[model samples]
Target chain A: MELGQKIENGMEGRTGIRNEMQMSFDAISENEAFARLAVSAFVMPLNPTVEEISDIKTAVSEAVTNAIIHGYDEEYRQENDRETKKVQLHCRIEKDMLYIQVKDTGKGIEDIAKAMEPLFTTRPELERSGMGFAFMEAFMDRLEVVSEPGCGTVVLMEKRLRMAEEADEL
Target chain B: MENNYSENFKVIDNYLMVRMPEEVDHHKSGYISRTADDYIMKEGVGNVVFDFEDTRFMDSSGIGIIIGRYKKISYFGGKVFAINTDTRIKRTLMICGLHKVIEIME
Candidate 1:
């Protein structure tokens, strides 16, 4: 699965990382589907159920879409003609828990609190539901957003996998 | 997008039936929205029925696609229906509180 020509990849571990992978790709809408699909494949070793796989994929989709749509200001990018925008996805698997980090170096969020509000979209003309963060929170066990104006945004999400036998509990 | 996705739109009994793609996301939302809205405007489609049988993965962008169409048609008393929704899709609808606006059918 390819998403926006992977620019860089690396592996780093701090807390006894079982497996970790990181890749950076162009921040274009074309990557949203492939990005999530790649993460879904990365977590397959956990033996996630259909529901769990869906959950992880949806969360990744939301994060990557946010990075492309909101992080890189469409108007500014269009004016500058510098479409080399990039999004970084880093995933680590330790035990049954999956940790995901999606980062972008585009214009950061001005008000993180208001941006996370359900149904509050900055680009209403585009028909955005403003449910990106909300959906990420619902699907993942933990979600954290850190951003600064003009610097960029980073979304951190973690999900604990349940084997097939335990999938029914969810 | 290159394969004339508008073919997926069909008007039956005044209801616009949309055969969603395999993966609905931001990349495809523009096409879905443009094609569906055209039917709603030109063919005068009343209600909208979104068939998710082909959709293996969908994010919140799918919600936007549904709601954008709902907003355009609901003013004329048109309703939106989601059919063939699975467990994950149902959970997403429930999470976003979309049941209040759109009807989910088995």
Candidate 2:
């Protein structure tokens, strides 16, 4: 099945969301960086200002870095046995709202709730502040995490750019 | 990619001075934080002054690192100060409420 088909199958039954786009790439830090920029560009034509753009970029970077550094661990693993793992990102923009899903078929998070806690990290050796989810939550309107042991992990985030009152409050 | 670090000690006391480069971002923040941590331990610096004469960009992560350092040195009765600033970093400092704690040099 195509990558999009796989993601759709994985995300099925959760919500009847549409206008989704899926992008997949081999597990590389550079790829993760590029994915962030691509997602930003994809959302830019919607007319977000430079500050909004920076917030989105920072959130996307945290998400992508988490995928590469925690989800995959391919970079630190032995390169000789490197199996090309992939990080798939699915984005949907509808009705002035943006929903993003980033999934990785590598090591699933041990405790989803704990991982979301601010300043809590399982990979301190890698200098991860465990603040990825916190930043995502701070930047976006909603954040959801779904994972299964030995299966994979998916992070879903939603944000609305048109909420002027909400923006002022934030 | 461009940064300068100097380890200078006072002639009569045990204080270390770190002039953090003007531009601090995700890439250089960690390095500067680590260097400051190590320098404090090695030089037994009582007070740390971070001369932000040329700093342009700093986010929450940078603030976190600074806060971590402040807590680390507080046991020794040492304090941290930020010297100089631009509008951008100043706004970040204000948002993070560091101005209430750290002394900002004029």
- Per lDDT, the best of the predicted structures is 1
Sort candidate 1 into its docking category.
high
The C-alpha stretches of model 2 lying farther than 4 A from their native spots are A1-21, A25-33, A74-80, A125-127, A163-170, B1-30, B42-44, B47-64, B81-106
DockQ for candidate 2, C-alpha atoms: 0.13
lDDT of 2 by residue, B1-106 (tens): 3334534212126555666654444445567778778878877777777767665444445565667677778788988777776655565566556788787775
DockQ numbers for every candidate? 0.87, 0.13
Task: Give the Cα RMSD of candidate 2.
Answer: 9.4
- Misplaced by over 4 Å in model 1 are A1-17, A79-84, A164-170
Q: What local lDDT does model 2 show for residue B82?
A: 74
Docking class of 2: incorrect
Per-residue alpha-carbon lDDT of candidate 2 for residues A58-79, written as tens digits (9 for 90 to 100)? 5776777677677767443554
User: Residue B103: error of model 1 in Å?
Assistant: 1.7
Per-candidate TM-score against the hidden true structure: 0.89, 0.66
